[model samples]
Target chain A: MKREQGAARGLAQRMGIPGPMGGAHMELNGNREAVVEGCGGILEYSEESVRVRTGKLAVRFVGRGLRIKCLAADSLVVEGFFTGIEFLW
Target chain B: MLAGLARWLLGSVTFSVFPQGGRRGAGERFFSLAARSGASLWGVRRRGEAFSASVRAGQYAGLRAPARRAGVRLRVSRRNGLPFWLRACRRRKGLVAGGALAAALLLWMPSCIWSVNVAGVSGPQAQELLAQAELLGLFPGVPRGDIDPDLLQQSLMRRYPDAGWISVNTRGSVATITLSERVETPPVKESGRYYNVKAARAGQVVSIHATEGEAAVSPGDAVAEGQLLISGVWEDVYGASHLSHAAGEVLARTQRTAEAEVPLRQTIREPTGETVERRSLRVFSLQFPLTAVPAPQEGYSCTARVETLSFGGVSLPVSLYIERWEGFQEREVVLTEEEAAAQAWREIQAQTDAWEGVELLRAEERAAVQGGVYRLQVQYTGLENIAVESEIFTGGGDEMTGDSNVG
Candidate 1:
């Protein structure tokens, strides 16, 4: 299953098309809103920071008054006054 | 905002997930498992060792297995929305019952008329109309189904043949009755009767045209009051005398005189400070006095005010009536000569105005104050119709005797 998924991703990259299962995609609007698609799961949750897992790494959001506005299986929306974002493998 | 309302209507539960042994990331694992099972969650936050979030009420039950597998315990912190509200209402039976009863009354009360309003008429005529309406079974507190507006309108029209238009409209709890009375025309007299047209007042004859009788006087003829202008008795071509109803128009130049006198000292009524107030309530057609004081018998002027209760823009049959009576005392007032003269002139003008169908050609007025009395005299020369009908006696008497010349 991993090999087949890797082959599909490589094919999509060669064709110059973004694949749906490629990796986690994060969209940010100013410092107030963030939407993360293809998220694996929540790693940590708190008022100061939130960590969400992508394919091979986790995205950490450092902010004040951070909250998860919505959470589904593969997507989640975060709203807060953001200061920084970090990726950790 | 729309999503929040949708969640509230569909019902939702806010719960806290506590890890089994204070283990970190248990809340995240639980959320991941629950979300995989198609449960939506929002407001996920951490407070001490427990993480709190809300899930759809129907999906909350499915979260238990996920919580167990993720080594977490779920405790509902608060419930929101319709399902919880209905559950709470089940415990208070009286509130539900009272709400249902109030709703039933709101649905039923509008089926009956609570008030009757009569428009386009007032005073005794309005009262008479209301009485007639009551006799026709269109009163307050009567069911609307029993009232047929068209039938009631027809009945009212029959009762008042002089009414030009009548309408009955029932809307909600109010019944409005609208009426317009017709102007009556004078009855035409029978022409078969033997009658003569006589001068109503002494005047000089200006013009006369007889249609059914012989003209008694010519133009410029001086006639006395009660003198005949057109005689009903006339001789036919065969020389046989015949009596018929006289029909003619007689225009005359007449003189009118009016006199008025006003005393310098007169008695007038003046209101005293003392006043009595009476209050009453009328429900349907019955009235109950709220005040115990009886109405003043004499020497008092009264003013009344009535206020009706209304519900939801519709007037109700219940009303409050208040009567205020102010006492009066007679006082002698002395008037100046100019004031009295003005008053006497006003009276003389009022008397002259009472004369109808007269066109004034000339007017002369004289005013004098004599012995504390102001007297006004007015002479008016006018042109008017002077013909008036006088029935002749044809009761087996000699028909020639009915002529003015013979009488």
Candidate 2:
């Protein structure tokens, strides 16, 4: 079932249509907030860096004063002076 | 922010774990287990070898297994929210009991009337009104909710027939009674009875203003005591006599003689300056003496000073009583004849001043020594109105017959 979802997400990306688990809707607002939906779990957390797990990739937040504002079952909210975001498979 | 508030309301426990092996993934394993178990954790921080995390209080029990699996020792550092406070209260039952008692007292104190004030009345009637209020169950220490102002006013009006109007009002713990008393009216006199204006003293008639009678004497006319100054009987043109009530003012110059005597030797009380004081507690009608000093008899004078606390117009049952005993001795005093006569004259002068509308024209006093006493005889001449009214009695007959028999 996860493979089907992954295939569907790939097809949607190719067709440029939005779907579930479409690489975790990442919203960076005002360089101080980062919200990621469809998140799995926290891989790493610190004042300067945070790594969150998604369905197919790991999202690393690199910044100063980076702290987890909220952590739920399927969402993650990080707040700080964010400088960059890197994706690792 | 809303999520944080929700977590707080649900109650949360923050704990720190000391990892045995210095392994880097110890905190991560705890977070992974928390996520798998559907328990959200936040505010996770690290201090050297210890890692702290906040989890919902209900999920804290589930974290012990994860801590053991990760080879870490878990210790709860802090607890927050409402459930923790309730647990604390259960442990200290006395604090809970005290809080409940305070709330009960606050709700009960205002329900009773601690004071009662009686307004718009005073003197003997004030006492009477208070007595009436007591009979109606409207007094201090009575429950405020039990009194109905309308019913109390009606009861008071029914009790005091002389009260024209009455009103009862309540504010908090104080009750005020406002009332006005009824005015009494004089009775009317019957016109059938014959009344005559007569002289109360022997004097020369200086002026006469007769309102309802014939003038029996003119001004400057000399009259004797018991003389009739105004005649209530009149003769008609048909030679019939008619009687009526005579009302008038007659001014006259009258002579009054007053004699007084004062003894040369007199007995008086003198204080000996020796005194004793006692104190007591007075509760209602009962007095409990604090000191054992007995009250003096006969030659000692006792004075009492009482301090009491009153609410509204009602006196409370508590008071402090102070009794002071002063000693005194009786002694004889001798006076000269001149001093004795002067004292006698002062008494005579006070007596003469009691007559109303009396204008003194002349006064003469004679002093003489007599048998261990001084005698004073004072004669005072004054101009005053001396007319007095008297009812004339007649034989048993119908008043319509106009009987002339005046006895």
Winning model by TM-score: 1
lDDT of 1 by residue, A1-89 (tens): 98998898899889998775328888899999999998988888888899988878889999999999889988999999899988888
True contacts kept of each: 0.79, 0.40
Kindly report the docking quality category of candidate 2.
Answer: acceptable
Task: List the pairs of residues colliding in candidate 1.
Answer: none
* Model 2: fraction of native contacts: 0.40
What local lDDT does model 1 show for residue A15? 100
Candidate 2: lDDT of B365?
A: 79
Question: What is the C-alpha lDDT profile of model 1 across B1-407, one tens digit per residue?
Answer: 89989999999999999999988788889998888888989988888778899999999999999999999999999999988998999999999999999999789878988798888997778878988999999988788999999999999999988899999999887899999878777857685567899999999999999987899899999999999889888887998888888879999999999999999999999989889999999897679999999999999999987787977755678999999999999999999988887888789879878999998889888888888788888899999999988888665755444444412
lDDT of each: 0.88, 0.81
Residue-level lDDT tens digits of model 2 in A6-68:
788789889989675435777889889988988877788777778888878888999888777
Tens digit of per-residue lDDT, candidate 2, span B152-251: 9999998876788899998887788989867677845676687878889899999999998788889999988778888787778997878888879999
**Candidate 2 local Cα displacement, residue B277, angstroms:** 9.6
- Interface RMSD of every predicted model, in angstroms: 1.0, 1.8
The residue pairs found clashing in candidate 2 are none
